[model samples]
Target: DVKVTQSSRYLVKRTGEKVFLECVQDMDHENMFWYRQDPGLGLRLIYFSYDVKMKEKGDIPEGYSVSREKKERFSLILESASTNQTSMYLCASSLRDGGYTFGSGTRLTVV
Candidate 1:
């Protein structure tokens, strides 16, 4: 079975702290995406990678960065945590056929 696992289900961090969110897929998908879900903003894309060691800036990538060192692992990094950055982060993986499999998600709260 294919699975996308997130490192944390919930997290709390202080302002200005660096945060790391990790995601891993067992399906060997070629594409992975990072998105943050907010009340009004909906799901905004933060970063995406099509292959190992290759990343692309998504809709909102100002204070966030991503690293894809291996085919099954993708990491999201928050340069500096802010209150506004608190949200439910989702990770998704897909193949060339175009259907996505999402992780359980990590809810982060920045205070």
Candidate 2:
């Protein structure tokens, strides 16, 4: 079975702090992505990587970044956490675009 594990289900951080969210997939996949869900903004892509050591910025990568040093693992970094950055972060991995298996997601709250 394919699975994606998120290290944490929830997090609370102070403004201006650095935050890290992690995701790992059991299956070997070529693509991995990070997305943040907000009330009005909906689901906005933060970053994605297609291969080890290669990443691409997604739709809303302003205050976030990502790392993919090894296959099956992806990390999302909030450089300077802000209250507005609070959202539900989703991580997904797939062999290709047609099949995206997502983790449970990490809900972040900044204050």
Candidate 3:
């Protein structure tokens, strides 16, 4: 089975702190994505990397960034965690013409 594992199931951060959310996929897929899901907004893409060291910003990329140094691992970075950044973060991996496989998601709260 294709599986994505997130480093945390929940997280809490204070304003202005740097936060890192890690994700790993076992399928060795070529594409990985980060998205933040909020009520009424659905899943808004933050960033996506089609290959190692290559990334593209998505709809809501402000205050967020991503790194995919290795084929199996992808990381999401919040340069300065803020109250507005608190939401459910999901990691997904996929290949061409394939459906995305998502992690369990991390529910983040910034106080």
Candidate 4:
């Protein structure tokens, strides 16, 4: 199976603290993505990388950034966590098809 592993299943952060969410895939997929899933808002893309050292801003990149230093790893950095940022973060990877292999997800809450 194309497996994507996330560093945390749940997280809590203060309003102004920095946060990091890690994701790793064993399939060596060329594409990796980070998204935040909110109720009624659906999935909002944060960042994506198609190749090493190559990154692209997705639909919603504000207050967030990503790193893709290797083929199997991707990281999401929250410059400053806020209450509005509280949501379910998901990591995904894909090769050619549009279908993405998703991580179990990380639910983050900012107080």
Q: Indicate which candidate wins on lDDT.
A: 1
Tens digits of per-residue lDDT, candidate 2, 54-88, equal: 99999999999889989989999999999989889
Q: Supply the global lDDT for candidate 2.
A: 0.93
TM-score against native, each model: 0.97, 0.95, 0.98, 0.96
List, residue by residue over 13-81, the lDDT tens digit for candidate 4.
Answer: 999999999999999799999999999999999999999999999999999988888999999999999
- What global local distance difference test value does model 4 have? 0.95
Clashing residue pairs, backbone N/CA/C < 3 A, model 1 = none
Model 4 poorest 10 in a row by lDDT? 92-101
Task: Decide which is better by lDDT, 2 or 3.
Answer: 3
Q: Return the candidate ranking by lDDT, descending.
A: 1, 3, 4, 2
Stronger candidate by lDDT (3 vs 4): 3
Over 1-111, each residue of candidate 1 has an lDDT whose tens digit, in order, gives 789999999999999999999999999899999999999888999999999999999999999999999999999999999999989999999998999999999999999
Better of 1 and 4 by lDDT: 1
Query: Could you tell me which residue pairs clash in candidate 3?
Result: none
RMSD of each: 0.7, 1.0, 0.7, 0.8
lDDT of 3 by residue, 1-111 (tens): 769999999999999999999999999799999999999999999999999999999999999988889999999999999999989999999998779999999999999
